[model samples]
Target: MSEAARETARFAALAEQSNVGPHTLDQLQADIRRVVTTYPSRPIEPLFHEVRELRDRAFNLLEGRQAPHHTRDLYLAAGLLCGVLANASFDLNRYHEAETQARAAFLCGELAGHNGLRAWLRGLQSLIAYWDGRPRDAVQLAHAGMEFVPENGTAHIRLASISARAWGQLGHRTEALAALRQADEHRERLTPDIEHDDPGGMMSFPLAKQHLYAGTTHLWLRDPTSLTHAKEAANQAIQLYQADPPERRRLGELALARVDLAQVHLATGDLDAAADQGHTVLGLAATRRTESIDKGLDRLARHLNEGPAATSPTAIGLREAITHHRARALPPGETT
Candidate 1:
């Protein structure tokens, strides 16, 4: 080749190498971790800006990569950003948008040869399906996620818990219990530093989150001991969340756990405790009224109306307060 052509080629190759090198990848990975850590405790709208920017940056970097290793790292970084974007969309109740982002994440995971991220993508999809009122689809997605995550880790545990939740919602008690047991078994096998590639916050399924799921599942099971088990799990989750740093604590999950406690108290005929707990939850920040927490409060309200508390003055007053809180919690343009 001519000297000028060779010089141009060398310059282009150097630029590509510098762009996709380990230092750049590491920085991108750190940025993703920051996004994940910041998401749980804040509103999705602002977080969306950061993740969207990161996704775009990743795409630009990926387009410039030539080597296989560089491509893999860039794909992983891009996949993580897409997953975060999908989660933020789900939080905003934009299920179709979330699915589109999730599909993009799945493609990145596949291209990156990262089964763990792929499994996580499925888990995110399953969560969206569950909130969309498609429990069967959630179950199927969880099963698919499990196939990608063959090891005993947080991702597998999350899939098992998702399965349990779907089964519980379907009123299949035995299946739900079995799935919970499977999750417990997997939890026992997790490595000490399981957060190796998992950036702790939303991506890693910690014990507290697992307990939250267990509590919710047991509430749906509603067997003779289910209520008691549900209360215990919810209490554990609350304790764990309370101990976390402000950034790590998931206020919405904590609120849902409180909802579980309130419902269990109501079921056990402790009207005063139930009412007080419900009042406290209603007084929480409006941002804590995530879809899951809203649904839990609805279930609590329904139970109060349909059960013996239907005519009690205390129950009636509490339920009215809850309704008002929910109305106030609606999205800005949603209030009629």
Candidate 2:
């Protein structure tokens, strides 16, 4: 076949892949990666701008600046925006920001009567809460959100994943595994047709997200097997982020790097590398102020203090940096 024909065929395949159902953050990102890779010369900025505009319009409508006639479209747009922003925040280790955006999206979705979108937003919020050291809250939110959406929707999958993480944090291994099983079962039932019914806001429900969540759940459970799952998800996410523009993709890279370093250090008992990664994540957190990254850093610090890793210079440096930063941020008398 001619080169042009080959490119056309490749693009077609990517389009087909992008059509896979139950849009999740991971799925949408994977689709974006597939499209950009297949058509390297294509202008991605335009697409990003278009989606962002839609989100802005939706927010405007929600604020009553725009007529209510466009409520559905606005809700859908907000949902999509939420997914995009949440994914970006996750990539950048700004879990708190991701949670806030996701919550806003879900509220808009609820007003628009988009149950699926609301569910997805709730799941995103739950993940943020879990990462921020609020496991009980995560569990509560996930359970509550699941009631609003279909069992097989992307939202359900997210809720299940978050639930698993919360359960793991609560030291309930069996419950966490059960949630994982449910997530897997939902994945099996997914289809391309479901994408069309995605309630406008939750667009990309990719398989990589499933792996990412599974890996996270395993991490919380402190199981070695979870490392493999996380590694697979991180690799896919890293590839997708690399395929996009740097400004648009830095968050994903940070997330991939954070997870990779965390797992590796945990496995190898290398406190210094883990501490370095924690500090790197803190730098990212400075930009987004996401609670997840902050809490993760705190957790790493605590772990280092308790283990042989505490003696490492890198660990000490990270701890000092965190303390200094926190101390500087507080009022004079509030310093502890």
Candidate 3:
């Protein structure tokens, strides 16, 4: 080649400046997955800072020039970070903040044209609405998510399961059961494209988690007929969680499942079993605790004042223990 052509080639290769390196992007992606996967097992406070740092890094790069491919990657990573933040906020009982974060994440999904991410974000928003006592809104969000229908993975199934729970809360048995059936159909048709679900962790809806949601849905139906279904589903969820490897065990969800089982036992007038499960949930380390656990325990405490079991020492003791647990927990929406 001519000397001028060689010189031009050398300059061109040397002049490609990037705001972020490929290796940095790779490492950032790895950390995001790690945070996503480990969230159920560890405390959220420390991880909150880690996620913020990672997000800030991505956001700063986003403001600078990058190839189209790198921009998409940065947005995806940033979106996942926002999602984790949303979940953490919801766990802390900051519903408004959580919704804002989910919306931001959804925008990132749009930028990346990632249907999987968009679908999952809708599910997250639905969950927040359900917990915030807006079941009707939750159902609407789930239906909207159905429009995305990811090419692979269980995002749609997650939406259906969430819809089932929301419908149950609204006391629409027909709609709730239909949503449950839809979830089953989605699961049966799922193609396990690891690439579809993106950063998994809590984002991926596994069978065990699905069963837990089913149990909650049945419990919420408030129909005498659903009590048996609730008990069976809750027990099955517990068994599945126990079968997972230690690292993969979602202790928070397991505790929630046990609380559901306990509530079912209460509904059936089985005070002893209820008390047993209640104590087990209360024994969970602080790090593994979630907002749902506290709410479940509160429900148990209220129910304890009704039945013949109300006069029992076990019932009184459980109420006292619940009061103590709530007293010790950091108030929601606050930080240490």
- Residue-level lDDT tens digits of model 2 in 1-336: 699999999987765542122343344444434432322122223433444554564455466533343545556556656665664455345556566667666766777777776777677677667766789999999998878955344667768877987998897889988999998887777777663334322244445556656666666666567656655555565565556565444453255347555655756676656666667666755543433444555666676677766767776787787666555331111100
lDDT per residue for candidate 1 within 37-122, as digits (tens), equals: 87788776667887888899999997774577888888988999989888777766667788999999999999998888999999
10 residues in a row with least lDDT, candidate 3 = 327-336
lDDT of 3: 0.86
**What's the distance in Å from true for residue 128, model 2?**
4.7
Report the Cα lDDT for residue 159, model 1.
93
Segments of candidate 3 deviating more than 4 angstroms? 1-15, 192-196, 331-336
Of the two candidates 1 and 3, the one with more favorable lDDT, higher being better, is 3
Which 10 consecutive positions of candidate 1 have the poorest summed lDDT?
Answer: 327-336
Question: Ranking by lDDT, best first?
Answer: 3, 1, 2
Q: Highest TM-score among the candidates is held by which one? A: 3
Per-residue lDDT of 1-336 in model 3, one digit per residue for the tens?
699999999877765767778898989999999998998877766777788788888889899877788999899888988888888878876777888889999999899888888999999999998888899999999999999967567899899999999999999999999999999998887655543465778888888888999999999986777988898899999999999888878988999999999899988989999999999998873657677778878888898888788989999998998999998864444321
Residue pairs with colliding backbones in model 1 are none
Model 2 has an lDDT value of: 0.60
